[model samples]
Target: MKSNFFRGAVALGALALIPATTAALADGEASSYKALDEFMDVFQKVRSDYVEKVDDEKLIKGAIDGMLASLDPHSSFLDARDFQNLRTQTEGSYGGLGLSVTQEDGAVKVIAPTQDTPAWRAGIKAGDYITHLDGQLIYGGTLDEAVDKMRGAPGTQIKLTIVRPGRDKPIDLTLTREIIQLKPVKWEVKNGIGVINIVSFSANTGADVRQAIRSIDKSLGRKPTGYILDLRSNPGGLLDEAVSVSDTFLERGEIVSQRGRNKGDVERYYAKPGDDARGLPVIVLVDAGSASASEIVAGALQDQHRALVMGERSFGKGSVQTMLPLSNTTALKLTTARYYTPSGRSVQEGGIEPDVRVPQLSDPDYKNRPKFRESDLRRHLINEIKTDNAALEEDSKDDPRFAATAEELKKKGIEDFQLDYALKTIARLAAKPGGAVAQAAPVRKPATH
Candidate 1:
């Protein structure tokens, strides 16, 4: 009798929920139709009564772009040309100025110029605003249009008017376009230390990094004292490449975990059972330009205790973007998930803080140069939990160790002060009786499975 009563109660409860659920769903559909009607009304009116004859395709594209723009800076609608450009970029070769830029209130802002690119050679620092393109005021244009203007034939030259903070005059620069072939990994042995510079995490970046380690060992005829992973001014790329690179150094344990909207929707990546560097001390160098995948690598190594991160705070872009192909020539890049470091730290607005706060005394404008990060962008996702790193910043200020100026550093034959300091620090660690490897060990043991 009790079982029959329970079944009857469940049937009645389900019946009671059906009407309310149906009503709520019907209301939602009605509201959506109403919004669509309003959109269609505006579209029709604009088509019929606009001052100029605007093509339907242009209007539709603009509407789509505006919708995505309202969502987030990273999310966007890629047209045919834009889609092709993205594919070329991930493949590590493109015909452009090699600049990663974003739009802010209609103004194009430089994120970071790729190393060895025309923009980098021209001294276009991050946080500079691009006001004009080729003598035309492009202040209120779309980012796509500005990028299109900057890219052209290999020999073509374009003029740019930049407005940098802490500067009086608007600087004018003339840059020639070229095929930007990105060398994802470049390695060299400097004073018994292996320095590997990862410019961008493009295609095959992981394999390239592994090969770089082999090449460095081959050149030295033995293992170097330590390794410096230079990721400064690197505006991040493929997520898989970042995971693979982190896995190379980490013998085991969780490298990173990404959580989607649902509570249980989580995916974790782990390292295989192999340490490519053989437990050697590693130092990662990052700056305000290091973002996304760069942050992933830095955060992983730092949390895993596999490397000492030395430099300024990273760009703090921790959200994962998934490319949803809409058609053969276009797609929607949507922000899907927020990634966490092995220690469960979200690097969204608060970037990866270096273990050692080493300033770039080599750059003359290091003191005055403004920093651009993910938080500065409009519509950026907010991190609910704030990272308590204010004390870290306070500690770095007025540090006597980094008081030397650019002129003084040049006199000392140190073009890159941060790198020199890192190299010297590694040397000192190696000079210790037990070596750097003894001091450097993973916080957790290798996972058996």
Candidate 2:
């Protein structure tokens, strides 16, 4: 017999459908009555006969994960705990082993340990594959499961067994959890050039950048001739923060745009007049880890000729995710729309390529070390020639001029190639006519530890 009661229950629980389930509906209309009736019968049959008292939350989350996993690696559902962690990342404080872990090649890989955190101090480097945590094998587990195992209260200890490239055996390291406050922005006047390092885009990122710029001005008593916005290894954050950061550098121009399934979803953000830095020669440093909001800022600056991008391609996360609250403290972070640069470029699968490609110079010892290479990973790079060419056609703009090749950059013999290039570029620009004249000011020396 067809279960009419079950059909009514399924109809009431509209939230059970996946994010893309809406697309299954036509013109904003719900599924047909007959389809819902059949779906409910199957759902009840599965629930009633085979399993133990199944958790509705777990089942829902699993369904959500399955749905998102099929779409893209980057898009996934964030439960309450996951959402809290996401919030903590932006606030720059969290209690954990202090390593950024991401899903790579069907397993969790440590991207990099936070500076001065337990993971870094314990000799956990970027590109280490985590095999086990606290003797619990994580080989086939999800990224969320691995993350849950790693995060805990301060002063708590967790053991991580990892496999490195050159090492034959898995190394076990026990680390204590601590409150990690990420330093998003670091600035210094190196060799009479202003160099700013943007580790990530966060809620406070715009304020942080402004503060750094002001501090530089106070020390030098004049604006920098040129500025370097280093976005290397930046995994990106809030979109509003990225827009605000771009606004600081640009006077009057479109920053970025967004497009969705509906034409009404299209929107553009522009820089306000007062916040422009004018014609300061600027360089944006990027790498494979630089993504989303980072890509937005980099793409906008490069397209507008406001900044010269240095380094390899970015992480190419042009999609915008919005959090939809669910009952029982759970939430869904769905990809709501795809973003484009001011020049109408979609960075989705095709990341923003640098105007200048400067690859990292590997030390002899570091070369053989287990480290994550963007190229070595599969999902990191997607051939988006179609998207790139389409966006180029719409914008009708030429590509920016690349300064030097990766080979030339490797020959510099500099410890930090990106910073070195920025300093050199700034110095050259300063020597030009009508450039910023450095004023003699009492340098406030950094305090000794």
Candidate 3:
């Protein structure tokens, strides 16, 4: 029988989401006794003749980890601790520094920080490399070890030594841990516009987004001019949540699709029959940190012409991961398929290119900081059909509108230039004679193969 598919999830750090389904074995594969025999021989040799006595469990787990690591960066064997951590993160509250990180060449690199958390408040950037923790060098250590050292009881302080590129000296900062209650969807009225900031796509994110739209309308006493969906620095989460969020604004259309190994093994998600915002103009704001689920939402809106995507190219992670429970306490996060946007675009190495590329002028380091994306990861899945992203690269020369220095913008009381620009753009569109922001044209429904 075909394996039953369900909800999907993804992450840039230690977790990715999907239905808790067991992995299906190959339909026509013979057991390789020779390989099993070779593995057993090595295990016996390590157990009897190694420098020290190694536990069987440790050796076996190591073997499993090595095998998964060889396939791709997203697949891994999750132990008990990792399984628990995944649950906590998906639930949207955890006590830690609130940073999404990944290991590259034995060094823990920042993926992005959860906004309003200790790491973000302390000005930690996406490309920063963490070299030491609490005055002790942590280089060449396991990612889990670094993560364990970083997370602690709430209100406790930890010192981090960061090695940021383009800086002569390493930067040191002490930050206090806090319960990172990830407010997935937050809304406010910005100059007669509804501004919805989605930090992560955790549990109930879609419902929260629908509520935000309702709340915005209620607070304004009428429909707002437009909406700004701020997905900047979001490190992605549940796949179902992404689809739901996309469905909220869409009237009817295919949102996304995931294709597995077999030719006919494909699943497509579609929006239900209602536009929650009543077809209001939407602008999706993304950056290098926007990934997987974030890409899913952005790509859906952009392809359907439901929203104008603004900001840099996304973090390019289009693969879906299935979490198959190995036992009650552990699981395997295996990359099982590649997802595509409504236009059949797989953002594997080439992320969603924004309709308009807006530079972050309020951050002084915008010019020098190198962007990190899924394509940068070791053993990342290669896109068989390459995408030419030369035109999408951020121009070295600044646009006149973005030439203002961070200090200048700070003086003007504009903390976030991207949001500020999006709000104003919506306002301008609303100012047109009819005062009705343009809605997406009706698209032809896609047929499932």
The Cα local distance difference test for each model comes to 0.89, 0.73, 0.88
Q: Please, what are the lDDT tens digits per residue for candidate 3 over residues 298-383?
A: 99999888888999999999899999988888999999999999888899999989998888999999888999998989899988
Candidate 2 segments exceeding 4 Å error: 1-53, 104-106, 111-116, 120-127, 153-158, 164-176, 275-278, 362-414, 434-449
Q: After superposition, how far is residue 283 of candidate 3 from its true place, in Å?
A: 0.7
lDDT of 2 at 308: 83
Which candidate do you rate higher for lDDT, 1 or 3?
1
Per-candidate TM-scores read 0.94, 0.75, 0.90
Best by TM-score: 1
- Alpha-carbon deviation at 226 in model 2, angstroms: 2.6
Q: Is candidate 1 or candidate 2 better by lDDT?
A: 1
Sort order, lDDT high to low = 1, 3, 2
Ranking 2 against 3 by lDDT, winner: 3
Q: Which prediction has more favorable TM-score, 1 or 2? A: 1
Candidate 2: global Cα-lDDT? 0.73
Question: Compared with the true structure, what per-residue lDDT tens digits does model 1 show for residues 115-151?
Answer: 8889999999999999999999998887878988898
